[model samples]
Target: MRAALLCSAAGSLLLSTLTAAPATEDRTGAAEMRGTAVAAARAKAAGVDFGPCPDAQDLPGRMQCGTVSVPLDYARPDGKRIELSVSRARATRKDPRRGAHTVPRQGALLYSPGGPGATGLYFPLIGLLPEWKRIAAAYDLVGYAPRGVGRSAPLSCTDPKRFFNGPSPAPTHPSEAYKRERVAQAKAYARGCAERAGDALRHYHSLNNARDLDVVRAALGEERLTFMGSSYGTYPAALYATLFPAHVRRMVFDSVVHPDPARIWYRNSLAQSPAFERRWADFRAWIARHDDVYGLGGTAWEVLRGYERASAKLAAEPAGGKVGPGQLQGAFLQAGYYDDQWPHRAHALSAYLKGDAKPLVEQMEQHPEAAVEAENSRAVYVAVECNDAPWPTDFRVWDRDNTRLARVAPFETWHNVWTNLPCAYWRVPRQRPLDVAAGPGELPPTLILAAERDAATPYEGALELHDRLAGSVLVTERDAGTHGLAGGPNACVNGHMEAYLLQGRLPGRHAECAPHAEPKPTAPGSRAVGRSR
Candidate 1:
């Protein structure tokens, strides 16, 4: 949730540099409409509105909380009114001084937390990145949950635990029966979501979310929109630019996702497994050196075998009636996102291997605590991923792809499959995915940041996106393993971002950001992963 993954009212520009602009009155048609909807939706959805300018009285300008009513289906916009829960913190420095009026209206920024499900309505609260406060000072930082996500009309499936702790598509034998069960479980999850969510499910597409951003913009009364999109949010930002180019002012897409329609994300993530396995190996080697602390394995190979054994143990008897292959794999996926958390995972693996069971038990306990948030997570994730393109209904395809992938990348292949298995059964109707190579849709100068070694959204994907975004400047965090590449606070990456957001300067067409120095030892006082957040 720290990265830009949540949805919010309107779109935004990534303003690194600042400039002065006129401070207008507090009236906004967009704000008014949003306010009305917020009041109404709050009555129905029981969402918190937080009203206007709550704690910002100390600040200079006003902020508001509200919602927008969108259709359950874009084709039938006039049909059922699906509520988009939203919150806004308007420009605070706009009216402080006359000479500073131009600078006062620092404009606003819209952020996305990428889950299509993660909520960022609390961007300020999330305190994303140590430097975010500086960014928020000049601009209004606004965020919201997409439909079927936090505070928004959420989706809940029966036997929700099954979603987290079910048997995945992986099998040691890779038998036809295994594939059948995988497909059945996937399809059942999809049907369960569809049966409960119905029309609400259909409208959760990224395109719709992008359009909802427009409505948010209109409601906010902003002349233009600025955005920071990561992961799946990149799709909506791209789509919004294509659908309404004029509305966009500036945008930044991090950890870019392939907008191609032909490939299912399940397939794409499978492709990433090898890369993650590579990262895990690196982690395991490090853990070997620190065996005195972890004791899970005496060598990298031992640690590797330990994880395999843990997976086998879970497959035989899921921990605490949960933490099956899916949960274990899902947890690993989170761990793999960055290097700082590797120790946490290593410790958990070590403890589990020793049969202490506390760490793994602790991990399972955290799941139920996040149940509501997890639903929001699953809802938004499936909504956008499912709608982006049609997934093959044939379970045989998934079975084949996953089984083939698990051969070399056994780490999370089946686990990844089960994590995304619900997509095969997504209740929402499908739409065409965006073309990654489709040139940027008349966007303002955008900064594209990519890790040279990102596994989730591979570096090549960024290169592809850069090629498509004619006005964008691409920078590579050379050899970095993490996706998105922003939180390192490296002088090369952060300086470019700061220069862009504050000065509106674009790096040369292809900028090469210096790689971070070899990471300092992970002992105490070292810069840990997500330290910025």
Candidate 2:
């Protein structure tokens, strides 16, 4: 878990007036010269060959896979190198619309699925979806596993079973003994990562990942890169835009990450606490509205009480000897991520409360203990997040903040704390986070999408990013709670994205779109799903 309003034209004008003009070297002629130099460098570097995709054989369309080698440390390019896995689905249309930028005819639409650690090798599949089919027809949809993720030299610490099956972060009884145990677990996690990853961890920061993206761009023979970054993916994407504005043609950021340099991982978690609580409340209300089917309660508070009791029961006696209080919370946390999941989650909760533990246990089963690939993903996630910026080393600071947060937003506060605790003890040297503020006209216009009530990446972050990325347009999904908004069911948001990607057009000012009506309760035994966009 990680974590805007429209501004008037007058405000936009004021921002543009305050921004500094590009340097003399950043003018058109100089930019073209720089691009030529980059192309020459790319020509000298190792080239990629398109072949059948190794991981996903069933993916629709003509998918090609290749690898590009980038220096592990740009400062010592010849010292060490790592390969990043890349995949692309070529455009289906013969005559694709071109943007106004004077770059090698609008290249592929590159996408990054955020996780800081999430493997993006398969994200091109999104373009194959019916809603995005048209966009896919125009531009090749490209995806790559960022360094330290998936096939790109993944990072791993302890065995997945040992790591995931350890003590719960949220103790039923917050005794001193419980606190000590949690701290011990966090320390062990940090030590294990240090021992397992060693020097590799030092190279897993976001800046390095952004640099890697540039190499991918060059290897693809693209003079300009068009990208869509979601969730945690926004950090590197934003960094890419900041470092190489001349290279970017169009970019879209969804479920935006706040680009605050000081508050990277720790503070970001704290910000998500209230957002999770709010989403949890919404879930409770939804369940209450369907009391006839769930029979959990008739009021939100009543529903919450039932949930607390269930959690307590699971803590005392793990369901099917696997699903415990923490596991239960983890399962429900998905509800916070996407409202489309509410129906299944509600049904599962109803089944659990009605003395049938099978559904709950099934949900727990979804979180396997020995999935090495998943463990690798977590490792890379921690590696990038913990090393990207400084985290408070003092346990007392964590204890105090979490204790206070637990009082008002107990839903995911402590769980989130423990999830990020390893960062406090990360061995890698911290890097100063980038000051992402862009001057007016410094970069091409970008599009931003956010939901008003997203829990993972709260709505406030999108607004902050929109303000920082001068000339950017923020398209809001009013009352929506989903994390990634573009590829989902919201035609309003998707339509805007299509317009920007196909034609270099964005809203004249900040805009908002209403979400679909909340899911109505379905009749018992019906399999209708309430979709969320």
Query: Could you say which candidate leads in TM-score?
Result: 2
On the 0 to 100 scale, the lDDT of residue 287 in model 2 is 91
Ten contiguous residues minimizing lDDT sum, candidate 1: 2-11
Cα deviation in Å at residue 360, candidate 1? 3.0
Q: Which residues of candidate 2, in runs, are more than 4 Å off?
A: 1-40, 43-45, 94-106, 166-169, 366-370, 520-533
Alpha-carbon runs more than 4 Å astray in model 1: 1-64, 90-103, 126-129, 159-175, 264-267, 296-299, 313-325, 364-366, 422-428, 436-441, 517-533
Task: Supply the TM-score for candidate 2.
Answer: 0.88
Structural RMSD, model 1: 10.3
Between which residue pairs do clashes occur in model 2?
A: 114-233
Judge candidate 2 against the unseen true structure and give its global Cα lDDT, from 0 to 1.
Answer: 0.76
- What is the C-alpha lDDT profile of model 1 across 38-101, one tens digit per residue? 4333343543354754345643343456676665544444456666666666544533324345
What is the model-wide C-alpha lDDT for candidate 1? 0.62
